[model samples]
Target: MWGGSGSGVDYDVMEVYHLPTGAWDQKPTTGTPPPGTWVYSSVAIGKDIYYFGGRGAGDSGYQYQNSLHCLNVDSFKWRELSPSSDYDPMKKGFCGIISVHFDGEHYLVIIGGLGSSSTPKQPNAQYNNSFGDLRCNEIHYYRISSDQWISPVVTGDRPPPINDFTLTPVTNNTAVMFGGETDNGVSNKLYMISFTETSVDILEVPNPGGSVQWPEGRWSHSSVLITTCSGPHLLVVGGDYAYDVWLLDINKRKWKELINLPNNVTRRYWHSLSVWSVTPTTNWIIEFGGLTEYTDTAVIELRYTSDIDWSTSVIPLDQYQDQLRRWILSDWENLGLSKEVQLLRGHLQDRKREFFEEQLQREIKEKEQIQQDRDKEQQQLLQEKATLSQQLDDATTLLEQAEKDKSSLELEYNEKLNAKVAEILEEKTQVEEKKQIITEDYEKLKLKVAHMEEQYLKEKHIIIDDNQNLKSDISEKDKVIAKLTSQVEEQSQNEKQIITDLKEKDLHIAKLVKERQERVLKQPIKETSSIGLQFNYLEEQLQTKNSKQDTPFSRFLILIYLLFISFVLSTNYNSKQFIGKI
Candidate 1:
């Protein structure tokens, strides 16, 4: 039996009543630490109920607890173990404490939880914030034989500091942890930690799309692992002051949401959840009292049965009704001493039927309203369709006109390009004729120079042979020399004339290049102007067609508007006429 006081206490107490003969007996307190000591971790070893690590008698808000106490179930006697100074260095709250018999000896294991200190602040002097202080991820072990604490060196990427995560022993050395809140302010991720003699390996379960997103990150949720016919499965229920329940397949490492409890059920968190295999084929998971969001006075019991395939089993609505029917039938068969109760039940059932009918009518009315809304949407769609059809026709006409303009512009551009090509050919012919004339003049100058050199050589030989008349010969030689000098002067003049001609030709070529550049620059602008004119002309024609089409469309719209108004008026008139006839 469980009862709570109206005082705002952090912990609520529960009395375990053993009713073998249908009589109640109050069990004595195990350790009288104080009133309101919130029990966190408990395990039954033999006849003694061992409790570990719970907050007591202060509003420090669920701080780190170190007390270890045991209650003998047979005699109801309490024994308190001395607190140890040697812990895992990190003080933690909501740590996973479990009792496992390894090699015929009992050992208590503690895992990750909220640490004692806040996170360290960053180095910026102006922004030393306190939000970083949080939890630590560490594992510690306590040996029952030596009554001593042993810190085992477990290796792996330690999980982020989090609390309220479930740690269920899947096997002797394996434990699976699922959804919990982290201190770094992130969603909870599913993690599994396996232990060997040398190290611990933490593996993350990958969520390939679908509804496998971890149960919305929450804390203080209860989880229990049980061996079913299909194998071991983890069942989690009522988390972070909520009413949601979920199941996790340990072998598959996937979570499946469970059906929500009925309205009569209460939401709870940080509750005592335990699984008991009632039969080989059936398991009963029970939830005891916990603090609800509204008040701590609330007490609720939720029992879920686990079959072979608990993940796929869905409780049918008909099954709920059938169970109610069975209960009613059983009560009626046992109502021989109370006949009036059966009549009351019949009256209640009739009232329930009437309420259900009223609810059904309300649902029908809502559906009819939804249908009317859909009809209004259909009418709007029809109007939009007519408008779109008109726009499509206008667009098609514009496209045709644009095509015609484009073809005409292309024809004009080709004609202009052909004319320009002809002009370029005429200029090229003129340049070629000038080059031929210059080459002929150079050949004639070469022939004249060669003839003058031959004549000078002959005069020099004649003067060399006449030795008798030396002065006369000298005069003749001077004459020959003068003739040769004049010839050389003429040849130099011809060569200078040829050089000047070549320079003039180079100038002419440069002028032609400049003119060609100017023409090339102007051609693109001229083509663009012609194309622009064509585009403008097409646009005007398209506008005219669009305007003509718009007149008909506007008339159609006006007709539709007038028809709608007439329909509305007629509908109202008919409605009034019918009312009058009635």
Candidate 2:
């Protein structure tokens, strides 16, 4: 079971169930930031939990927030830190927070955050124009002694402009940041940034290429610097859009990819990772949910072997005490306090009996519950087995019956097929016998037809030759008759020609008699005028008649008609519409 502080979206403090037998009753400090807020840095020093440089609240579309808050583990109280008197303002967003304890003093270092700078753009800019630019690479130390934040000058070159990078305290003075998205939006570089009591140094760690790179270039990843059997190693677990487990050997400067997490473990980012060393051999790292691009409240656990690497061993409390008692008694004897050591040993024995009795009763109750659950599961398995056996028996019987039915059907089908085959064979034999007899009869009929055809052809040839001789004789007689008719027609034509010559001579004689009669009549009429006068009068009358009928206008009329004819010819040539010419 899990518990959290705050109501609505601002669920900040997360409590996990750690006790084995009792219900979880722990609560986190109230008024912490909500669960979905991006907690960029966190470090636990002693019993204090300090978180800084997270962004939430306001209307800046993810306000670049810079506030430091601390949780007292015993009191569960929330404390917010303000800007130091010397510093300009409480730098938010871009700062890196890491906890370090050196020389018996704990300090929370805030380095490189977005702070007050020149306004980025003009007032009338179309884009969002609030928050100033990133500040210099000054590291501010929160000294727990003075309860004040101090801006310390960082030595060497500063890290490139970046936000949301993970910082893990490898030693009391050194911290490693790996694979965080820069302001330019590129990830995948390991940076070893260390701070001594005097100065800070940043070194770029070259990547050793392999199937996968170390510090797997991601933003909002959770990492914890832990001491294991192999010495101080940084265990980098989940991150934004990553599911691989990576372990960085800080001492050896090497890296190893761990096995994949179980299905129940979430591969997420921007979550809280905390390491609590319960014993010298066992250290448990608890991860509470943060923004997984959206709000997430998934909690995950990872167990690491402690530096001492103590294996499981049981030591009876009585035996442990007896050894301590003997050692203390020896020291007392040298110090002359033997009587007091014996009294202390007697008191421990009396309390041990009562404690053992209580432990025995609790163990008995737990064993009984375990036995009951085992019995119930065994009964269920038996019932399932019985039911499955019965079903299998029924299936077997049905399958046997189906097989018998199939066999009977197959025999009947075969018998029917055989009877059909026998009937077809008998019909085939009768048809073959009939076909042989018909073939012999066809051959005899063919010979008889051939003999009749030969006899008919010989008679047809004799008749054709006799017809040819008769046609030749008839044609010769017709030609002789045609010659005799032509000779008779020629004699008739000669007689007719003689008759036509006599008729022509008679016509000539008649014409001569008519001409003589005309001449006699003309001689009688000429008595009234002289012959010359009659000739002149006739010539004048002819000339006057020609002039009156044909004037000069006739020539003009002829010319106009000729011109109209020419115009008609040209118009006919130009008039292409009738022919549809182009």
Specify the highest-TM-score model's number.
1
Model 2 spans with C-alpha error above 4 angstroms: 1-40, 56-62, 83-90, 102-104, 113-138, 210-215, 263-266, 278-282, 291-582
Q: How far does residue 429 in candidate 1 sit from its true spot (Å)?
A: 99
State the lDDT of candidate 2 residue by residue for 1-582, as single tens digits: 122222453244456443222122446556544221454356677787776654555555654444566667777777766421223334445456787766888777776545434223212111211335553344667777777755554545466656566777777888887766555554667778777654567787777787544655677677877675567777776666566667777877777766645422346665666665533334455555554443433333333434322232222233443433454455456556667767756765665576567768967998999899889989999998999999999999999999999999999999999998999999899989888888888888888789888988988898898889889988998898899889889978976974674466346434633553454356754422332343345345435544554646434543453454334334424435322421
Residue ranges of candidate 1 with Cα displaced over 4 Å: 1-14, 17-25, 30-36, 58-63, 84-89, 118-134, 196-199, 211-214, 263-266, 293-582
Task: List per-prediction Cα lDDT, in the order shown.
Answer: 0.59, 0.58
| lDDT of candidate model 2 versus the reference | 0.58
RMSD of each: 49.1, 24.1
Where is model 1 poorest over a 10-residue stretch in terms of lDDT?
A: 121-130
lDDT of 1 by residue, 75-140 (tens): 766666635123433433566766655677777777666544432321210111125434556566
* C-alpha TM-scores of all predictions: 0.45, 0.44
